[model samples]
Target: AIEHDYHDDAPYYMLLAWFKRVPRSSDKVMLLTHGLMNINRWDLAQELQSIKDDKRSEQGTFSKD
Candidate 1:
């Protein structure tokens, strides 16, 4: 669906599609991470998870401020 809609820009447009369709940022991250893992891209998935963790930590700190 995203590839069909984006054509040549699917890679970049996927994020837009996710945000438009998924509602939450964490769910967006999970969707992308799981998709990558399904394709055996474990390294990328782990990296994304790390980034998500970092962002959550940052949000937690900011909320305490």
Candidate 2:
């Protein structure tokens, strides 16, 4: 799970972008962490966006669904 500050407005997509680049973690863990981050941000749209981005990345594209 992620520790978050609701007052912070840093773009959620940025975190997902970085998550995809880390070399040592499993996809499941990355997704789980992303989930927690979005939950903490109270941004369902960002959560969905992250999942779509992950799928696109797995398919060799980094665009939207």
lDDT of 2 by residue, 1-65 (tens): 13465336456677767667866656655565567676685465566667778876888753434
Per-residue error (Å), model 2, residue 54:
0.2
Off by over 4 Å in 1: 1-10, 23-26
- Assess candidate 2 and give its lDDT: 0.63
The 10 consecutive residues of candidate 1 with the worst lDDT sum are 17-26
Output the number of the lDDT-best candidate. Answer: 1
Enumerate clash totals for all models, in the order shown: 0, 0
| Per-residue C-alpha lDDT of model 1 across residues 1-65, encoded as one tens digit per residue | 88577687866777777678875546778888999999999999999999999999999999999
As a TM-score, model 1 comes out at 0.66
- TM-score for each predicted model, relative to the true structure: 0.66, 0.29
Model 2 scores worst on lDDT over the 10 consecutive residues at: 1-10
Error of 1 at 10 (Å): 4.7
